[model samples]
Target: MIYLDHAASTPIVESALNIYIKSLREDFANPSAAHKLGKSSMKKVERARQLILKSLKGSKKDQLIFLSSATEANNLAIKGIKLLPSDRVHYSVGDHPSTSEPVKSLNSQLVEIPLLEGGVIDEAKFLESLDKDSKLVVLSHVNNQSGNHYDILSLGKKVKDKFPNIHIHVDGVQGLTKVETNLSSLIDSYTISGHKIGAPKGVGALFIKDGVEVETQLHGGGHEFGIRSSTVNTPLILSLCEAITAGLEDVITNNKKVKRINSLMREELEAADLGITFPFSLDDTSPYILSFLLPSISSDIVLRHLEMKDIYVASSSACSSKAKGFNAGFDAMKIDQSKHKFVLRTSFSKDTTTEDIETFVKEITNIIKEIKRL
Candidate 1:
């Protein structure tokens, strides 16, 4: 089967999986326990923490809080902030529901920044929406729906320089390993997940900038520096570290390959004369994901057609599929309302191949013809 939903999750690499199994069997002691075995487990966990910090280019002062998934990290980031009725919380309407849900549920006041037609965070709109009374701005390093990404270094700096007291939280699940992140000042927190980058599901981490204090969201054992209080998933943490290392080793080469695959697919689509449209070009967005606007057919139908042929893709974020309303990205991009129900996301992983793209293109071209005839 051809799986093109890497944005939702990826299969764990063999190296990472092997390490996870070994740790689960041998290093099963509780890191918090007061014994030699526990001390050893604690040491391994710290080592993993160091590896993760290095990936984010964070400092020793920065703390990495391991959570179950990026959703939890996002929740912690949003709900952890101390908000008043007068203090406004801000984020792009196009962000993953994980980012938007907590803000919607927990904050009394919210200001949603709109995106440009090309799926970019509208800088002018953002500035207009932001106010001194804002408590935090949640930004995604890579938008989950559309592949268009943000330059975190510049954007984070821009936000902080203008609003010194306001906080910046980044949901970097799609961006962390795909791009270089030099965590600078003013960026208060970042959320990253393992599954999106070849690590196992149910493992993610939050980075709290030095000197930044977000109130603890979960309570119990006082673990994770009191930010979260569950017993650490030691096996998954170690596996996540290994996945990071393995992902980085091939990141440069994989990016080039994915870019080539995108070009190939675009070439085929253009040649086929389908009315399908893509939100952004190769250089403008991520090399890993594409949101294709189908021609006169619902994406759910197309998805099922592809799946029956042993191919897999998504209509939108798997997390937000059941949520009512149109995708914020499409609405922001001003993709025609007629095509709204037909947007399907095709995402790639490091191992995705040219043949896979070719096969998907051929099948989609045929599907378009079949639908047109009907």
Candidate 2:
């Protein structure tokens, strides 16, 4: 199949797979144990941590806590901070359910910032929500569904300018290893997923800036610098480190290639007279994700049709795909119900070739025309 669902999860890189296999075979000892085998495993975990820090341009002062997925990291970031006080949490309306749900669960007087039509949070509105009492402000650097990039550096500057004490938490799941994230100086906490950047699933990291007071989510042995308690999965961590370091090394060149292919796909769809809306044109957006509306078609139907042709894509966030009916993300964007029903998301990866784009466009064009005649 010509997979176009990189946003959901990319296939693990061969290098990462090799490291995973080797580590599983050689470093299977428990990191918490004090024996020689354990020490060797612990050493590998520490080395992986160093690689992750280097890849993220973080320092020893920054705390990198490994979790199962971005979802867990987000929950830890939000729920951990919410323990501070009531009504202290703020997040944009477009955040993944993982971030939004934890805040909702706390019933912590949430301040949902409005997003522009292009699906980016209004910085001014976000700033207005901050106060001395505000404990955390969670923002997704690049929205998962719309591919919209947020000017997090500018947002960070504004947040620090207004409320220097307020912590900024960024969910960088979509942006990690794809776009330049130089907000290390501005951001207080950042969340990244291993699978999104071609690492194995069930491995993710949370970056908490020095001196940030976040309560632990898991409670045993005080591992991950006392923030998370699980014994480190040395093999997965090493694989994640390898994938991220290798991915970031060529991210600039790879993103440009994907962007060109994305542009061609958009041009082809438009040239074929398929009704489409490119939301990113209205605001800061990522080049890797493309969401468009197809006239006279349901997203489910289109998805199935494409799959039948050996092409793969998505209708919304992978986390919410199993939910019945329309996605809450599209609803938040104010996508008209009719158009929402027709919306499809096509995500690109560095491995996505020009030939893949051409094939996708041709199949989509023919399918839409056939559907139009029905």
Candidate 3:
């Protein structure tokens, strides 16, 4: 299958897979054990941690906690802060369910920031939502569906200037490897998923700024510096480290290539007269993901049609698409449901090529024309 669903989950890189297998065979020991074997495993985990820290450009002193997925990282980031009685939470309505759902579950006051039609959080609305009680603002550095990029530096500085005490937690799941992040200067807590960066699933990380106190969600052997408790998965962590290293090595060149492909896809779709809505201004979006509205067709139908042709894509965030009558993006952007019944998200990986995008555009145009005839 020609997979255009990198945002949903990327195919594991061969290097990451090889490392995963080698580690499982070679370093298979409980990190918590006291024996030499255990110490060996512990050393591998620490080395993996160093690789992750380096990829993020984070300080050695910064806290990096491993979790099962980006969803878990987001939960820890949101709930950990809500433990404080004075902390009010603000998150964009357009955030993935991993973020918005967790923030919604918190007992703390939840403020929803509106997004513009371009799927960007309205900075003015975001500022208006902040108050003295607002201790944390959770924003996605790049939206999962629309790929719209946020000005995290400006937003972080603005929030800091106004509240001084406010903390900004950025969900960087979509941005990792696709965009450059200077964690030291931009954010307090950043969430990343291994699967999105061509690593195996079941491993992710959260970057906690130094001096930030967050209560542990898990209770056990007090692993992860008591921030999270579980036996560290050394093999998966090593694989993740390998993936990150490989991703970072060629990120700049890969990103430019993806952008060029996306531009060509858009031009082709427009030429074919397909109804399209480009959410973010091209200049303000990431190259990896492109979300558009297809008028007069249901997203479900489009997805199924594409699948039948051995092409894979997504209608929305994988989690929310499963829910009945969920309209997270529509609710956030106040988009008219009738004018846009279907949302198609095409995500590209470094391995994707211009020929692949051209085929996708041609196939999709044919599908649209057939639907129009009906």
Candidate 4:
């Protein structure tokens, strides 16, 4: 089976899986409990948090809160900030709903950042859009659909240089462990998903810069620095840390491998003359994901045909796959509305090989031919 939808979720790595099983069997005690085992669990969870923060180059004083998913972390980042109704929030329309929706929920005036020809953030226009009223700027480190890598470091520095008080929050679900990252002292908050790398689905983390005050979104026994309240998921946290460590260790090498696979997939598909057109520039986007348009074919039809052959791809983000019509993300990227239904996305992982791309291209070519005949 060829699974090309790593952006949705990746299979847990072996190291993470082992840690998860061992923790589940041996460290079942709740971290909140006052007993000795609880203290041990709490220490493990804290160590995982510190390890993750250090991996991201975050400062020791910075707070990393583990949550159920990146969606929840985005919510905490957006809603936790104290925004007046008159303040303005800048966000990309192409960002994941987890980030966009929360920014919209705020009563602040909304400014939509524009995307350039290659789906990159319009850096000049974005910097010009900032002002004293721009209280928060929410951005995606990597676009989930188009795979465009936003240079948060450069963007953050520019934003901070111009408007020192404007808060910058980044949704790094698709970028974590997949691209070069340095938290430094520019970004205010960043969100990460465990499953996007090689960890299980039930864990994610939010990094809030030191001195950044975030209001409590979930109230309970004052867990997660009193900003988020939940039982410290020790097992998931440990596994996530393990996966992160492994992913970061080989980021450069794995990225080079994935780039070859991505380029090969595009070459084979384009050579097939199946009327495929790439939406974003290959050079500007992350090599891990590639989305293209099919010729007069509904991607859903081709998706089903591929499924029958033990292959899997995605028509859009897994979260919004079922929703029909008017994809704000596509629109923001200048993708024609008429071609929305024809968009097909096939994302890869470090493990994806040249053979996988070859098989996928061959199968897709056959599927298109069959549909044309029908």
Q: Give all candidate RMSDs, comma-separated.
A: 1.5, 1.6, 1.5, 0.8
Query: lDDT tens string, model 3, 249-351?
Result: 8778888898898898888888877876665567878988887888668878989999999999988878777754457666576566564457788889888
Question: What TM-score does each of the candidates earn?
Answer: 0.96, 0.96, 0.96, 0.99
Off by over 4 Å in 3: 82-86, 324-326
Please write out the lDDT profile of model 2 over residues 210-324, one tens digit for every residue: 7888898899998988889988899999999998888889888987888888888888878877876665562366889988887757888899999999899998788878765
The candidate scoring highest on TM-score is: 4
1 versus 4: better TM-score goes to: 4
Report the CA-based lDDT of candidate 1 relative to the real structure.
Answer: 0.85
lDDT winner between candidates 2 and 4: 4
Give the 10-residue window scoring lowest on summed lDDT in candidate 2: 276-285
Q: Rank the candidates by lDDT, best first.
A: 4, 1, 3, 2
Model 4 pairs in collision:
none
RMSD of 4: 0.8
Tens digits of per-residue lDDT, candidate 4, 232-343, equal: 8999999999999999998889889899999998899889998899988778899999999999999999999999999999999999998786788998988888988999
Residue 316 lDDT in candidate 1:
85
Model 1 lDDT at residue 30? 93
Worst 10 residues of 3 by lDDT: 332-341
Top candidate by lDDT: 4
